[model samples]
Target: MADITHRRVRTNGIWMHIAEKGDGPLALLIHGFPEIWSTWKHQIHRLAEHGYRVVAPDMRGYGDSDCPADPASYTILHLVGDLVGLIDALGQDQAYVVGHDWGAEVAWHLCLLRPDKVKALVNLSVPYRPRSPQSKPVEYMAEKFGDGFYITQFQEPGRAEKSFAKYDCLTVLKKFLLVNGPDLLAAPRGIEIIDFLETPDSWPSWTTEEELQYKAEKFRSSGFTGALNYYRAMDRNWELLGPWQGAKITVPTKLITGDKDVGFQSFGTKSYIESEFLKGLVPGLQVLVIDGHHFIQQERAELVSAEILSFFGKRSGN
Candidate 1:
C-alpha cells in the first residue's frame, strides 16, 4: 500500500480535510453519509498504484471537514461548490470522480451543473436522478413512503440527533452501515429511526475494528447534526434546482452497486435501472450489479477497486 497523507484545503469558504495517495491524473473519491474519507481505503491505494492520484475527502459535515450549523448550508449547490473548489485547490481543471450513496447524488449534480469539472464519473449505490418538475423531493417522499421513511423522518432538526444520542457512536455507525434489506429503514409512527434499525449480529468481515473505531471516534466528536442536515436540505435542493429540471448528465459514467442494496431494491429503482428510462437520463451510463450489500466498496473491496481501475483506465488512457 502507498503511504496515505492527510491535509486540509480551503474550498467554498470552508476548510475541507482530504486523504490522498499516489500521483498522476487526479481521481477524486467522495464518500456518503455515516462515513469518512477512509471509506475509500481500498480504492485509493489500488488506483494510485495504477498511475492515478486518488484523493478522498471527508465531505462537509462528516469527519474532520467543517460542519456548517445551518441545515440550509447542506444543499446540493453547496456540495457541488465545495467539490468544484476542491478541484481548483488541487491545481486541476478536471478530475475523475467516484461517489457512493449521498456522495453519488452529489456527483450526479456535479456533472449536471458543471460538466467541465468532471472528466468521468464512477458512482456507486445511488444512480443519477433528474430533478422532478411536479413536486418537492421531501413532499414526494412523504406521500410515497410516508413520514416514517428515513429521509422523511430526518426532516426535523435535532429529532434524529436526539434518537442517535441514545446510543454510543459505534452502535450508531453499526446500525446505519450494517443493516440490510429494502425498506428496512422505515420506522413505525412515533418511533425513532435509530431504534427501528435492527442491529447487526456481527461485524462485517471486510472492515477491521480499527477502521470502525476511527470512524466512530470522528462521529463522536462531530455529532450527527452536520450529516443529518443533508437530508433536511432535500426540499431546499428541490426548490433551488428547478432550473435544472430534466437535465441529463452527459459525462461518461458507470454505476456499480450491490445486488441487494436497499436503494437498488426499494423505490422501484431496480426497474428504473433496467428500463430505458435511466439511459435517457444518463446517456453515458454503464451498469454492473454485484453480489453484496450497500457498502459494496468495503464489503467487496478488491472487486470494486478492479472495476474502478478498469473503467478509469479506458477513459484516462492508462
Candidate 2:
C-alpha cells in the first residue's frame, strides 16, 4: 500500500484538509455524508498506482476541515466554490473530479458552476437531479417522503444532530457506512437515528477495526453538525440555483452504484439511470450497476477504482 499525505488548504474562504498521493493529473475525490476523505482509502493508493494523483478532501466539515458555523453556508454554491478554490490551491487549472452521495451532488453542480475546473467526473450513489422548478427541495421532500424522511428530520436545526450525538461516534459511523438496500431513509420522531441500525454486523470485512477507528475519531472529536448542515441547506441550494434551471452536466461522466443501494431503490432512480432521464442530464454518460451496497466504493474498492481508472483512461487517453 502507498502512503498517503495530508495538507490543510485555504479555499473558498474556508480551510480544508485534503488526503492525497501520487503525482500526475489531479483526481479530486469528494466524500459524501457521514464520511470524510478517508472514505476513499482504497481508491487513493490504487488510483495513484494507476498514474493519477488522487486528492480526497474532508469537504467543509466532517473531518479535520474547518466547519463554518451556519448551515446556510453549506449551499451548492458554497460547495462548488470550495472545489474550484481547491483546484487553484493545488496549482492546477483542472482535475478529474470523483464524488459519492452528497459529493456526487456537488460534483454535478461543480460541472454546472465551473466546468472548466473539472476535466471529467465519475460519481457513485447520487445521480444528477436537474434543478426543479416546482417546489423547494426540503418542502417537496417532506410532502413526498413525509416528515419522517431523514432529510426532513434534519431540517429542525440541532434536532437530528442531537439524536445522532446520543450514539458513540464509532457506532454512528458504523451504522451509516454499513447501511444497505434501497429503503427511503427516515427516522421516526423521538427515536435516535442510531436505534435504526438494527444489528451491527462485525465491521464490514473490507475495512479493518483501525480503519474504522480513524474515521470514528474524527467524528467523535468534530461531531457531525458540519456534515449534517449540507442537508439543512437543501432548500437554500434550490433557491440559489434558480438561474441554473435546465442546466445539463456536459462533462465526461460515469456513475457506478450498488444495485441494492438506497439511491437506486428510490422510486424511479434505477430506471432513470438506465433510461433517457439520466442520459438527458448527462449525455454520453456511462452507468455501471454493481452487486453491493450504497457504500460501493469502500465495499468494492477494487472494482470501483478499476471503473474509475478505466473511465479516466478513456477520457484522458492515458
Candidate 3:
C-alpha cells in the first residue's frame, strides 16, 4: 500500500478510484461484492514486482469510487463500459483483466462485450453464467431460491441496506470474509445479517486486524447500498445484454476457485464448470480447483499470485 499510488479517473459516467503500480503491460484487477481494491493488495505488489503495471480500482460502487443513487446504474453494461474507459484513460489499447466473484462476472462481460480491450483473462471464484432467455434473472432466482436468497433479499433495496447497517463495518467484514465452508444462502424474516458475526470463528492466519480495519473503514463510510445494488440490477442487466445472446468469450483464460467457495458449491455450478459448459463458452480455457474458500486470493495470496504469473506466462507469453 505504501508504494501503490491512488488517483481518481473519470470513466463512463462515474469517477473510478484506482490503486496502481509498476510500468509494464497493464494488469487490471477488478474486485467483487463487499470488497475494495485493498483486497488485491498482495497481487498489486507481486504483479508489480514481476514487471507489470497493476491497477486495481474501487469499481464504481465500492470504496472511493462514485456511487450513483439509483440501483439501476449498477448494470453490467455500465460496469463494462467503465472498464473500457479505465483502460483508455490509462493510455492502453488492451489489458490483462482479472476478476474475483462479482468482478469475475464483469470480466466475463468485458471479454464478451469488448474482447478487443482485453488481452487475456484470469478469473477466480464465479464462473461464466449463460443468459437465460426463458425468464428474467430475478424471476428465476425468486422461484428457485425464494426471497430468502441473498440475491433475492437484495432486490427490495432499502430492506437489506437497513439489515446490513445493524452492525459496525468491521464485524460485517469479518463475518463476510471469515465465513467457513459453503452453506445455503438465506436471510429469513426477523434475522439480521449481523447475527453471523456473534460467534468467534476460527481465526484465518492470512489477514491482520490492521488490514481488516482498512476494508471496514471504506464500507463504513460508503455504506452497503451501492454494493447491494449489483444484485438489484442483475435483472436489468439481463434485459440490456440480450444483444450479445449466445456469444462466447474467445480470449485465452484460466479460472481458479476454492472447493468450499459458495459459488463453486452452488447447485449444478460445479457440474457446469467441470463439464462442457465452461469450455464451450471459453474456447481457450484452463481451470484450477484449489483448496480454500471464496476469498482465495487473500487466503492463499502467494499461491494465487503464482497461479496468475504462471497463467500469464503460458497463456499470453508474459
| Most TM-score-accurate candidate | 1
List the candidate 2 regions with Cα displacement exceeding 4 Å: 188-192, 314-318
lDDT of 1 by residue, 1-318 (tens): 259999999999999999999888999999998899999998888888788988999999999999999999999999999999999999999999999999999999999999999988999988877878888888988898776788988998988898899999998998898877766578888787889897787877987778888999999988999999999999899989989888788999999988898888876677787778889988969999999889999999999988988888832434
In terms of lDDT, model 2 sits at 0.86
Worst 10 residues of 1 by lDDT: 309-318
What is the lDDT, from 0 to 100, of the residue 239 in candidate 1? 89
Q: Report the candidate with higher TM-score, 1 versus 2.
A: 1
CA-lDDT, candidates in order? 0.89, 0.86, 0.86
User: Clashing pairs in model 3?
Assistant: none
Q: List, residue by residue over 238-307, the lDDT tens digit for candidate 2.
A: 8899998888888999999888898788757888888887788788999889898888888898899889
lDDT of 3 at 15: 93
Better of 1 and 3 by lDDT: 1
Judging by lDDT, tell me the better candidate of 1 and 2.
1
Highest lDDT scorer: 1
The lDDT ranking, best first, is 1, 3, 2
Which residue pairs clash within candidate 2?
182-262
